[model samples]
Target chain A: MNVTEQRLPIIELGSLDELWFQVAGTRCNLTCSHCFISCSPHNDSFGFLSFAEVERRLLEAVEWGVKEFYFTGGEPFLNPELVAILERTLDFGPATVLTNGTVLKPEWLDRLRAAEQGSLYSLEFRVSIDGPTPELNDPIRGPRTFERALHGVELLVQFGFLPIITMARVWDESQDAEILGRFRAVLHLHGYDRPRLKVLPRLLLGAEAKRTCGYSASDRVTAEMLVGYDTTQLVCQHSRVITDRGIAVCPILIDSPDAILGHTLHDATRGFAVTHGACATCYQYGAICTNPSSRSPDAHVRTIDRT
Target chain B: MRLAFFGGIYNNHLALATAIADARSRGVDAMWCLGDLGAFGPHPDRTCELIRENNISVVQGNYDHSIGHGLNDCHCGYTDPRDNHFAQLSYDYTLAHTSDDHRAWMRSLPAQQRLEINGLRLLLCHGSPRRTNEFLWESTTNTQFLARLCDDFECDVILGTHTGLHWTRSSDTGSGVFFRPPSPIHQVKLNDGGLKKTPDPFAFINVGVLGRPENDGTTNVWYTLLRTGNDVRGGRSPLPWEVEFVPLAYDHEQLAREMQDERLPDEFIETILTGWWTTCLEVLPSKERTRGRW
Candidate 1:
């Protein structure tokens, strides 16, 4: 892995129609090989966002015509004020939170359930399970993470919610149906039938970069390649993630100081050229914002030349 | 023409039930909530069943959606250094205090709802209609508020719940208004004008929470009595029974404790809960119970 110091670009947070709240910001219990942020419990490069901070951004977004809110983290649960912060945020619009599912307890689901009960807003949860079962997933996520994550999934099903289980694509394209089928059966056994599963591509950065390999020169995204491409499909086009340091361009690139905008939302809402290598993947694949209310990933994306 | 909206009560059932009881006592024509019968509260399924039993209209709050989809985050915004809000002491205490089927039953909540009260079209949403976890408050701009209300949906009023504080506002279109009742922020205030750097002194409710002239600093569990007609004289007014108000108790200590545990700025928490805890969170635990733990 290349350890050379690179001046992170100060990417502007684009005409932000939305804001992503990094509740636990760059803090996670497990340091995955392919984690874009290389988040781990010990890595305090970014800390948890205070409940007040989140509320503040949410209020600001409300002015920008933001229609929704989303949360992500090393493990959002790592932040102590997560639920309270979410409750505070839900009033602005619908909210979706991403988590590893390993730490999710039944009671936590209930509190969320309760909060949704009394409001006029909505909430959704996306659980991260990189592989179908432990064998395929534990290798990437760490020891026993799959088991605990699956258990957490069971609680969600038992509670009657069919959570969207997100997994980074680890196998070849030919394995999609097989993996999904196997996952369906597994969820059925655990009591979920119409389960929503999301498969993501790996971004070569963070712990994953060091664990295996980083993106090669061939992997870089060039400006010419984006001509006529759907730029808004990328999270950077319309969304900015708020972390402890400040608002950044997207959830996938937190380490770059350039990703950090000043203290306020108004300052963050400037144009950001997708010059980073990751910009190539976004151009190739599509936006990964994953709002349940949004069109499916297949909706606006073009057929990728996986030749 | 007057309707009431609220957010998840969890095992804060006592607090919520009290709020509802107060609303009922005040003769509120209708009461609604976002959704989340249970995730952490002791009575998950029961809370779900209660709404079903009462037929309380609601949109699926994140907890309800997460539970329905088998995801996690409690889906509530509360953070648990140990596990998000659901697993925390104050939140868990409420969940542990509720029933099982109740929590389980909450999974069936709808993600969105549309209601029509009198001539008003309302979006009874748990989160923003566009997505969950999106919080819109009175603190938001009239433009943002109008956009969320008009462009997002066909509702004339987004009786938005959550945030727990009560608020109401007229849009730029003058076509409708969006309202948020008392939230965990404790107090309730409408769109009068939060323009000043600080919050407004007069709030949505006389009891649940008030910004400035608060008792100890916490939300005062005040309720609103929107009469069948336009009667602002609900108790605070000169009119007799024609005037009604939402009456709620204030538990200042509990408010103080919950705020402290949540690490709310000491100045704000101390003030709201010191005087209002007795009314709102009792929802806020007592200082003795939440000290050190916070």
Candidate 2:
């Protein structure tokens, strides 16, 4: 294997638990107000990872015992080689692609189904819908983005993909039950067999830094906290995510310079300080980086990394 | 009935003997066996064989059950698909690498053990009586706790050995729903002498598994010192027993490999490694049981 200079940043990365790829880098059709990376139609700070690059990492990860893969970006659906990447990753293990429901074409879904033909490990799609109603979602994700995303989700079901809808815990604790209830009911109308849901604690960074409040002085993860804490639950302990620029500590901190891991996974395996304000969230919530209940996944939707 | 209280005796026979000695020191009259008597270190068969030779009451847990049932899975209910893959592999490796006799012995054990202690009918289950495979930690629901208390075991007392928490709780108000001290869960009821005020309830105490890590991240195993303190109203408070874990070295890598092979879910493997998810599990202090604790 003739290797050249790597594209991944020198992350001093945490653990490389899974092999990851991004078809479309910082580019996204919808400019979600709360996007951690502030992805938008024009944001190209990161480029798409090539299929060849992803395949190379997949083979490399296998040697090191990495057995899972995830694909994400502004919207993974925006990538032209999205289906090809899924086709390749599933031969060895399961692959999950996170997407905003907008811009998903029915034909693309049919192609995805065709590629997933006899594979034992299924392809998972997670659709990010911020609110149960367009009123709640449109405010953050832009006008009518919620409806388009929901429409995209329906197409996925018609094509045999069970899309998991991810949400931020926007409603208060009192309205949580009702919020989730309305959310699930809407998903049911869309023909999803089991509507999976995820509620993320607000990461006051990136575009979200402006949506409400960014990290305050109190949000930082102090050194004293890690002394006796079981930091094992933090995703950075055992996993590093790969993006077009380089391997980063996790999908959440993709934009942070500190998260920019080395070009190669071998160089990425180093200690990281849970320094960022978001690290506090991970520390408080524990296991904030990995999926919540991806095992025995709901046959359609897959949710991970809930602290 | 002979219930042996064992704390951490992996492969080191010396530690095993020490646990036995500790149990005897407390004047305990029976033998008890917590699961994972094997896996994670060096010897799988020896650990199982030693427990068998001692004639300790063994209840096959998720690990023990997996190895015995020839399940290529650890079945710990882990959430990560990849980690689940790892656990399944560990399960397979344990099944293929371990001796056939060991596998059969692991399978032969039951979830619940029956015993008769001083005119008291008893049910001795490995983890919890309801699901032999479920790990009842501090985060375990009262419904789960109460259900395990009154479930199918028609015994007067329910003795479990999984979660290493050692507190004897009795239903003080309703039936028998006792809450112990600080499982890091808020709203825990005060552990006052409140059982006599209850309806009809027995006892649910984690005798503490004789093997594996304790709550403080230390390797010590835990057991209870039941003083049989007959309250003025007529009840017994299970006392805490101090017994050091005799660390045994078993094929942990092999067990991990087996879990990986069986593709047991990752959340469960992690739970087995680290006791229970403190976040998902809540502790709402002792409440009056809605049913009988028998």
The CAPRI class of candidate 1 is: incorrect
Weakest ten-residue segment in model 1 chain B by summed lDDT: B282-291
The superposed Cα distance between candidate 1 and the true structure at residue A246, in angstroms, equals: 0.9
Error of 2 at A299 (Å): 24
Instruction: Judge candidate 2 at residue A146 and give its lDDT.
Output: 81
- Estimate, for each residue in B113-175, the C-alpha lDDT of model 2 and write its tens digit: 676655666676755675554444331223223322442344455666544454443333211
Go through the candidates in order and give each one's DockQ.
Answer: 0.05, 0.03
Q: After superposition, how far is residue B24 of candidate 1 from its true place, in Å?
A: 41
DockQ of 2: 0.03
| Docking outcome class, model 2 | incorrect
Once fitted onto the true fold, the runs of candidate 2 whose alpha carbons sit more than 4 angstroms away are A1-15, A295-307, B1-294
True-contact fraction per candidate equals: 0.09, 0.02
Task: Count clashes in each candidate, considering only residues at least 3 apart in sequence or on different chains.
Answer: 148, 77
Residue B40 C-alpha lDDT in model 1: 26
Model 1 residue A131 CA deviation (Å) reads: 1.8
